[model samples]
Target chain A: MSDLADLYRDVVLDHARTPHGFGLRDGAAAESHQLNPTCGDEVTVRLHLGPEGAIEGISWEGHGCAISQSSASILADLAPGDSPEQLRSRIAGFRAMMRSRGEVEGDEALLGDAVVFQSASRYVARVKCAMLAWVAVEDALLKLG
Target chain B: MSSIAPTIAAATALEESEVYRLREDFPILREQMGGHPLVYLDSAATAQRPVQVLDAEREFLTHLNAAVHRGAHTLAAEATEVFEQARETVAGFIGARPDEVVWTSNATEALNLVAYALSNASAGRGGPEADRFRLGPGDEIVATEMEHHANLIPWQELAARTGATLRIIHLDDEGALRLGEAAEVIGERTRLVAFAHVSNVLGTVNPVEHLVSLAHAAGALVVLDACQSAPHRPLEVKALGVDFAAFSGHKMLGPNGIGVLYGRAELLNALPPFLTGGSMITTVTLERAEFLPAPQRFEAGTQKVSQAIALAEAVRYLQRVGLERIEARESQLAVRLHSGVASLPGIRVLGPGLGVERAGLVSVVVDGVHAHDVGQYLDDAGIAVRVGHHCAQPLHRRYGVTATTRASTYLYTTEAEVDAFLERLAGVRGFFGAAS
Candidate 1:
């Protein structure tokens, strides 16, 4: 493993171990059920959009293998105050990162530890597993709009 | 590294020298995947064809390029000779009379012929055999939880068409069939007992003679799905005493669009044809069409002649190795593969463990990693394996998993391939950070 990969693995482990918001949002703005049919991973993400239409709080609850659960945790931690436009770019950046197409050119600092999984892109099949939670978040945000 | 092919060495020592040499015949095994030699562990889906089979096909299309049983010309005679010769080869390979074999698009169609015949009987369209196959209220069709969809669903459809009931033999935690319970279920009501000889997913080898005995005692016809077994084992359908047997050519180093259905001559002569068209008719009038004998009555429309010729060559190749030797060689490889995968931490095998009863597969769940991820990791490493339910969802449910990664083997597989797969699997969970 490269030095950068080692650093990334640590970041993923940290977010996976201690997620930000992982319960049902008491008064959420939008929610959706997400399933990775390929791997049988399922998650339900609920979001709370603020009065100004920015992501206020997001949380999730689901059951799956570790990669999916950890990906969900990272998504929960990163959703706090971003507008819809910013999150769309994040989704695109995440797609590119997972594909290992180019450098992860988004605001890597704001990826808030979710960036660790960026190195996991090499294993093409697990990208869907690692992206399960983020997909659910993106879906919920689209529905919230 | 001694550069010794340990898998081949073990096979060569197993009284099957010819089978060991079959490795040199397949061209795909020499190709590289991810810069490493491709370790093809997915033969259960389809076996790689050898040069002889491919060349035979090319020769047939190049030289004997005409329709069979037609024209009364030399090309017609040559084409017909090639087609019938292939049939005789396949029939002899399985110890069935050549007249008993019927060709179809694939095994599913072959089985559907039997199932639909019974269905026609229940509807009162079947003739003298109607009483033999007719199933209505109180009649039963028995199978097991480990059946591939091709074997299971046909019976299910049969039961729904008639008022006949469908009963299943259950599998234990390790995926072996509960044969003792099967003895009780296959009673007088059973009109057909259909199942796979080797499960496509679990890789557990069922007791054919035992199962056939129970079905026969009840006066029921037995249908064996030899899709998984035929390619790996030395099978004598007559010895097994099955009334009908179905298998595909594609999975056994033959061409696609060709399959076999072998029936007891007496039973086939009695049943009605499920498909009726041009070549299958004995004679035709504006009022009705009289169908031909057993084999012809079932093979409707144009046939997979070239593909059938290729399949016959495949049988010849397997015969050169000797089926008994092939069975022994594969069983040893299966055990080594099982031990290798089973020893990996947190991995749970989905079928009968060890040498007690297994064919050529190992379906497994890595403790915390999803099957697709394991598949991808192995794919990245250039080691191809099957992932997901393996089209045996109910079997997966019985094992308490929605999906699993299956590493299947064949005559051409080597120990180094198994080692490559195992090494990559050991590092998989850690690669995805699921390793606790």
Candidate 2:
């Protein structure tokens, strides 16, 4: 039961229910669509960059499990106002944390609420659900480049 | 048209004590998962093998382990005899002739073999003997929207290779095939009709007789995806009048790496071989090769000897239990599963509704919760289930959902397991804070 609680944290459920930047918007510099074929989860993320290469806005639209939807919401909330290099470092840290299998207590200052997904790493099949949105955003960033 | 009638009387359901005795044969059923007794409801993905099946394969490897069909040594002869006998056992299980059953790696490979064979024939490989398989621009191959990718994709590739158009028989909201649309879709231009005997996602037993009649009337060959049906029901390929059918061993308490492609003897002989190599040939020249007839021609290289032997043992196990009784028991489980899931708030059960006949599986969608979360919750409760589009993306698309959580049963499933699953499932939406 504790393990289930760790996976479906209150904050995670809240974010999933009321996601940030949940709708696709016009005038984005680039977009990428990602799908987790194992469970048919999909996300389309669009990136809007400022003049100096900062993430001016990140918006996404997709349908999937709570972990995936909330992760996208966290990304949408935290990505703006960060430079491309900073966002890339955050993505790297998230990936490493997810792969650690609950061994790594993620740096909360860097990951914010996204660190809650560290519990998802314990279950191999749920790892993809936690990573789906991050992958979509990373692909969108590459498209902008 | 020589389908074997089921020998058992029409029993409504198995006794709980009988299911408990059957459970003793499966050693894994005793193991605990997540601190609770494991309630395996994912038999549609792959069934748990009995100790008898495991012992049979082990026994073969221990005593008569040798290459089949090539060597003349005593061990080789014994192995060859056992292998052929296994083929006969599987043939009788499905009411097929031993000559008509070809071994492949799995049902996917079996379907691909047929698709590629048709393409080869269309390319003028088998000469006039294979003319019936040839398809052109005007010809069409029909599949259902509810078909697993295994059944649909092969025909898609075949149509691409042979210039035949691929048509779909769409389903209604309840996942029932539109027989009216099927009548319109299968016509003079239709070359082949491919469909599943039972939907892996919907659990709807497709009207095989009606579909076969339609295809036969239009001079089209019918291929049945029997992966979900053969393991659960009394299947008779000859009685169904399908030109070809494919099923996997792993889903039927047998080992992986073994599947059967049952075809009409005449059609199989006339069709060009897909995979050609050593054992399948009669005469090989530097320029060309003459192939053996039917089964051997399709089964090239070394076969899955041990796995085939194990599958025959599984067929015998099912036979001993009686498929009719198994079907009756599973049908009762299906009713319990469907009603139990549907009774929950915000839950929607896919496929046939209450009182409707269906196979022994239930797929559900919680209005506010995703299937992965539901699956994770169930897993935490030690209830194993399948969560996905179930390899039938078009069917999921038709239902207007991305994924679903499926719980399937087999002959060994018990009432307590079903109750345990429902009890765990009832808490999923609430635990995820999605309950209204």
lDDT of 2: 0.91
Pairs that collide, model 1: none
Pick by DockQ: which candidate is best? 2
Estimated TM-score per prediction?
A: 0.84, 0.98
Per-residue lDDT over A1-145 for candidate 2, one digit per residue giving the tens place of the 0 to 100 score? 4898988899899999999999999989889999999999999999988988799989899989999999999988889999978888889899999999989888888888999999998989988988998888888778767
What interface Cα RMSD is found for model 2? 0.7
Expressed as tens digits, the lDDT of each residue in B1-436 for candidate 1 is 0111223433443343544467779988889976877889999988899999999999999999688766799998999998999999899888888889999899999999999988887788766655767789889999889988789899899999999999999998878889889999999888889989999998888889999999999998999999998887777898899989999999999998999999999888878889988788877889988878889888888889899999999998877665555676677777877898878888878788775767767888987666865776787778999887776767877878877898988878776777888898889878767778
Give the Cα error of residue B61 in candidate 1, in Å.
0.9
lDDT of 2 at B140: 99
TM-scores of chain A in all candidate models: 0.82, 0.96
Give the alpha carbon lDDT tens digit for every residue of B1-436 in model 2. 2233455533546777899999999999998997989999999999999999999999999999899989999999999999999999999998889999999999999999999999999999897899878888999999999999999999999999888999999999887999999999999999999999999999999999999999999999999999999998888898899999999999999999999999999999999999988899999999999999988999899989999999999999988887777888898899999989888888999998888888999999988999998998899889999998999999998888989999999988999999999998898888877887
Q: What is the C-alpha lDDT profile of model 1 across A1-145, one tens digit per residue? A: 7532442365555555555577776788888888777556678888888899888877888756556677788777677788977776777777777777335543576565666666566556567777787787778778876
Ten contiguous residues with the weakest lDDT in model 1 chain B: B1-10
Please state the CAPRI-style docking class of candidate 2: high
Which regions in candidate 1 have their CA more than 4 angstroms from the true location?
A1-145, B1-20, B285-287
